[model samples]
Structure formats: C-alpha cells, structure tokens
Target: MTLTIEGFDHRRVPVADGVSLNAAVGGSGSPVVLLHGFPQTHLMWRHVAADLAADHTVIAPDLRGYGASDKPADPDGRAYSKRTMAADVVALARALGHERFALAGHDRGALVALRAGLDHPDTVTHLASLDVLPTLDMWDVMRGASAAVGFHLYLMAQPPGLPEQMISASADAFFGSFLDGWANDPAAIPSDVRAEYLKASREAVPSIVADYRASASVDVEHDTADREAGNRLQMPVTVLQQDWGAALGYDAAALWEAWAADLEHTTVTSGHFMAEESPAAVVKALRALMAR
Candidate 1:
C-alpha cells in the first residue's frame, strides 16, 4: 500500500532562491513545523503530526534534498548547509501565513532547527530536538571509539564525488542499515513507510551526502562562530536523546546547557528514531515543550 499522512493537505511551497519545498500541512491552532531525519522523510512524523494536528497546525516538510522536494546540488555543499536549510523552513512557515511558529526536529532536521533558532530567534517560539546534539558538541562529544559508530558521518563528510557514488551504488542497503539498526523496536516503522523511506533515500544519494558533508565542514564553522560569540538559543529549548552520553562518556545535558539558556533535557528509551519508535512519548514531550 502507498503510505500517506492522513488529513494533511500536501503542497509545493516556494521559498527563497527559486526553490520549492514539498510540505504536508494539517491541523488548525498555533503552528508547529515538524522535521524529519536522515534515512527517512516527513512520513516519519505521521503519528506525531496527526496527534499534534488536533491542537496545533502541523507542517511537515521534506527538507530540500530529501523526500519529494527539489534537490539542488552545490559544489561547495553550501546549499545543503544547515543555515540554508533553516532558511527554507523559516520561509516555508512564512509563506503558509505564520510569521512565528513552534519548531520540532528529529536528527538532520533537528540540526536545521538549531540553526533556525540561532538565526531566527524572533521567529521560532520554541525548539525541540530529538536524538541529536548541537553540531559543535556533536563533533566534540564524538571522539575515539564513539565516533566509529557514526562511520557514515565521516564517510559522507569527504570531498563530494566519492561518498555520493559509493552510497548510491548500494542505496537500499545503505539506507536500510540505519532503518534496521537505530530503532529499538523495528516494528515501530511499518513496512510501507520503510519502503517509502528506502525509495526516497535511494533516489536522493548525492543530495543527501551533500547535506551530511555540510555538517562536517561549513556547519561546524557556523556553529563554532556562534559558540565563540557566546550566543545561545534565546527561546526555550528541549532535547531528548537515547542517553548516548553514558556510552560516549560526556554529560549530554551539560553540553546542551552551553547552547540553550532554558533547557529541558530528557533521555529517551527509544534508540534514535524516537518519533516513530515511541510517538506518544515524542508527542507528549513536544506538547510539554510548547506548553512551557
């Protein structure tokens, strides 16, 4: 069966620089934009988005290079940089008639949300990140053996050509590896959604690699400058992770504290894909974040 987010109206919203993003808009109260991570598309938020739609206008989009959205490749990888991606979502919300909105992101989308808060504090009311650390702290905390687990990070970070080719060579296996490995409960991702994710991932190899490549280079630069300037997210920020701190031997909360002035840090039980593996808990957390 073809998977779809029920009740949401899908549209291709044009943002800046002649780009159009595929977004699913639903619900009716305060706007809350939902972002998905790597190896998955906006479909990752079906459960949470549907639940939140009851009380919030949920806008779930395929980040520029992922899902059914436009993919524009850049030689410097700047186009896929978190800064640009953040701008896309901010523009996306604005075009949808929301000047300011609540933001929640999982994985790559979370990184974009972090940048959005840093760059557009006045626009993003609340920020919630699922299973990720700030780009700078992420590179900092991930050292020695802990880094090995993210071999894909290093692989995709290299100069463009090769990483794209290699992953594209075996896209399904490459994408499926994460879908299988990360979820504490494999059944949390239904077969049709899994198929959709794999199909999207396979078709988005180069653009996806560019997204990761930006993280290791330009993203780090953007994050480092913010940290050096003593800038932190002015809005309320909450983070939910799988307690990688214990395994990686760093205080995840303390690291996140450095970036967020008002932080609500919680360790989740659902591996990396918390939204899908445990949607109720994820929805409850976001609801609480917005409430605060």
Candidate 2:
C-alpha cells in the first residue's frame, strides 16, 4: 500500500461538495502535502518532492480547478475560493489516512495553505508558503503600472465570465507568459515539462480563471476577516520569497510577519520559480522548517 517515487500512482480523490482532485502520493515517513502555484500542477514539486521523499511522505495534488482534476463550473463564485480549496486539501489528506500533516504551497497553493492554517488549525501541523503574500496583502500592495509584474492577477480578478473567456481564447500564450516571466532561467524547465504545463493549463483555463477571480472577492473577505480578528497562523510557518517587495516597493518580511506567529522568512535571490530554479535551497529551507 506504500507508494514510492519509482512506483508512484496518481489517483482521483473525491472531496466534499462534489469536487474531485488529482493527487500523486509517494515516500513513507511524516506526511507532507504539497500544493503548487498558478498555471502549474502538482508537477511543480517534482524535484522538491523527490528530495523530501527521503524522510517524509509527500502528497502533491492538482488543486480542484487545475490539472487533471474535476473542473465543475463555477455558478456562485464560491467554488474557487481558497477556503473551499483548503477544505478539499483537508478532506483529501484525511481520506488518505493523514489526520494531521505538514502542508506547503507555492503561489496559489500557498494561499490555500494559509487558509488551511486559519480554517483547520488542528489538521495542519506546519505551513510553508513559497513566493506569495496573503490574499489581502497582495491586493493591498497593488497600485498603478508598478503592479505590472502581476498583471494577470488584476485581469483574472475581474468579473468571472470575461476573464475565463479571454484566457480560454489563447490558453498557450496566457499560461506561457507566467511560465516564461516567473522563472529566472527558462532553460531550467525542461522543454517536455514546459509543454506538459502548457497543455494542462490550456485545458483548465476556465477553472483557473475562476480560481483567481475568487481571490479578488470572496478570498479577500476571508483574509480580511482573519486579519481584523488578529488571527495568526497557530502552527510554525515558513516563507521563501524572491525579494519582490524591495524591487517592487514593499517589505516582504514585514508583510509575512503580520500573519505568521512562529515564522522563518528567507528572501531568496533566485528566480520566482524557486523550486525548480534552486531545488537545493528549497530543500534546505523545508528541512530546516520541518526540524523546527
């Protein structure tokens, strides 16, 4: 019943609210669930997951709206909220026999992990977020042309239908833009892996847009509520970012400290895609966090 890298199997797990997720399981130690960034799949963790598999059971899943997972049409704008997605992770882990496990997310997945910490504190032992800010702080920091780096965030945050329609019109370009710009070294992403990412994202445009749209609205509400309540992540938290704030007009560490109680914030000089660009650094950071 144990899964390993050489013999890994991907399965579709059904969670509450009729959403099913594609999850890959491997390794055999302390459970560590991994969530990937936008326009990417669980595949984002391919390198980091292998390294962690040496001492931790790694569970990487395509979020509800991405990859090979079920993309149920969003009717009320509720489907793509991080809270709902966080619930999916919680349910998915429980179904896999992990009542409590460490959780880490990159990009969009990091927001999901933050929500998981807020909504299901007892279930997530530790939280790790790579290259992202909380939903509220993200929006708060956006202003004028300076926010051009995250143009997609503003575009996707618009009213649901338009964004999805436009993105679906040219899936390759839309997804490829982030893939190219976010990574410091595009060559680091193998051609085959890049192709696979574009293919998967092309098909999941609608669901992906909806997921981003939620962040501007419902996700913001949840984040604001937690912030106003002075709620901090109850578990140990680790944040690794590319020093975007200094270059783009904000303080990364200060922003993160507002949410995490016990935190280890490190600014990485590597590309935005830290996992692939600097897997060893990523592994070292995660290990240090896990040890704490």
Candidate 3:
C-alpha cells in the first residue's frame, strides 16, 4: 500500500553515531546518490532513479529529519545543519561500499549536495543541484518584495518554539500549500504520494524547522567561512534551475560559476519539482554531467 521506488531495496543504513538514513538503492555499476528536498521523500526520485538504475547504481535516501529517517534532536542547532547532513551522505555511501560516487540532489537535497562537493571534493566525482542555490547566495538574493515569495523560509528560520508551534497547528495546510502551488503539473505528484508527503511533514515539524533554521544560522557561518577561504567545488558541477534570475534580479549561472570552475548551469522549463515534472530532461542532464 505504501508508495515506493519500485525494484529498489530499502534499508536503514547507519551513517552517524546514533543516526541512520532510510535509503532505497537499486541497480549496479558506478554509484549515484540522490537526495530529496523538503516535504518529500526518496519517492520523489522514482522516475529518474528507475531510469538511472538501468546502468548506474542509484541510491536515493530520505535526508535526516525528514520522512522515515531518524530525527535526532537539535539541542544546539547543529544537528540538522547541511554540513552534518552532507557528512551523513558521505558515510552512507561508504557504508554501502562506495568510496566515491556521483551526487545529485533537488531543493534542500541540492543544498546538501553542494556542501558535500565543497567539503569532500575527492569523494564526489560529479555533482548536480536541482532548483536551489547555495546557502549564502540564497540569503544574499532574497531581498525587497520578491523575497515575499519565500515567506516559509523566513517563518521556519525563527527560533524553535513559534515556527514549530504555528506549523504544527495546521501542518497539512502549511505543507500542502507548497505541494499545490509549486508544481507546474499537479498530477506529477499523485494523491497517494502527496498524502505521504503531507503525513511525513505533519509528523516532523520540529526537526524540519530545525533543518531550515540551521540554514539561516550555522549553515550561513560555514558558507561564509568557505567563501572567505576561497573554497570551491573541485569537481564538475551541473546546476538545473528555473529562471528565477529575471524575476529576482540576479544571474543564477554566474553565481554558481563563482563556486565551481567546471560548471554547466541550465535553466529548466519545469516547475520547482523538476525531477517529477520533467524526469526525462532531468535524467538527460544528469547523464551528461556524469559523463563529464
């Protein structure tokens, strides 16, 4: 009855001292890890993962604090930071017998993949980020009236109590709004999968808020430090994004080029949930990135 990536074997792989990630892995040959974004699970990768599995081993995991993954408490706000999350990805891959692999992510997962590429260059052979900018660039660009579009970011960035309380008060409405509003094709996420996303988000309010909260705080500090030290992704990177630049008054590709020397940035026509909305295009772009 549960929706899942068909043909993939699911496991709870230990990645930290006491935390583990719920991963769905399939296929063989070179490995490719896919990370899901907010309000969704590895199920988001069902279409793309199935296609990729024909040749490349595809491992799609629900990131920490989301879906069926362990939600460790964030007593000091460091628990859900992208750095910590990125580390989990590395450890997960290694535990699954992969010392090096291609990495790709969508939304929040893209942010994690970016950090992993920056922090562990030799381990990630190639990188792809879907529909997200880096943490520092993200905060830098959201200004004036256009910033209002990301009201949820500001809301979840608030200190622990209020954000969790308000979101929990009406979890379905809060999480469902994005699912309903952000997709170009609503049928891309059918009723069962949408129900699953809403259910997972409804139960993980505090941890989800902590994940977003870190982006506004500790994640920014880490990104700022990296920028100051001139740290960059030392691998081929591909970024697929919607044309948020024209509307927000900034160049997305130029911004990504600063962090990656070998970068291919493409503006996608699909909605924010591009992997589901345009799986063939996503698969093609990822295959090209891996080839490079």
Of the candidates shown, which would achieve the greatest lDDT relative to the real structure? 3
Q: What pairs collide in candidate 3? A: none
The clash count of every prediction, one per candidate, is 0, 0, 0
Q: Candidate 2 — which residues are off by over 4 angstroms?
A: 1-6
Model 3, range 87-137, lDDT digits (tens) per residue?
Answer: 999999999999999999999999999999989999999999999999899
lDDT per model vs. reference: 0.92, 0.88, 0.95
Point out the higher-scoring one by TM-score: 1 or 3: 3
Write the residue-wise lDDT of candidate 2 on 123-206 in tens digits: 999999999999888888887778887889889888867887888888898889889988888987877788888988988888
How does each model score on TM-score? 0.98, 0.96, 0.99
Tens digit of per-residue lDDT, candidate 1, span 198-249: 9999999988999999999999999999989999998999899988878888
Q: Report the candidate with higher TM-score, 1 versus 2.
A: 1
Clashing pairs in 1: none
Ranking by lDDT: 3, 1, 2
C-alpha displacement of 220 in model 3, angstroms? 0.4
Candidate scoring better on lDDT of 1 and 2: 1
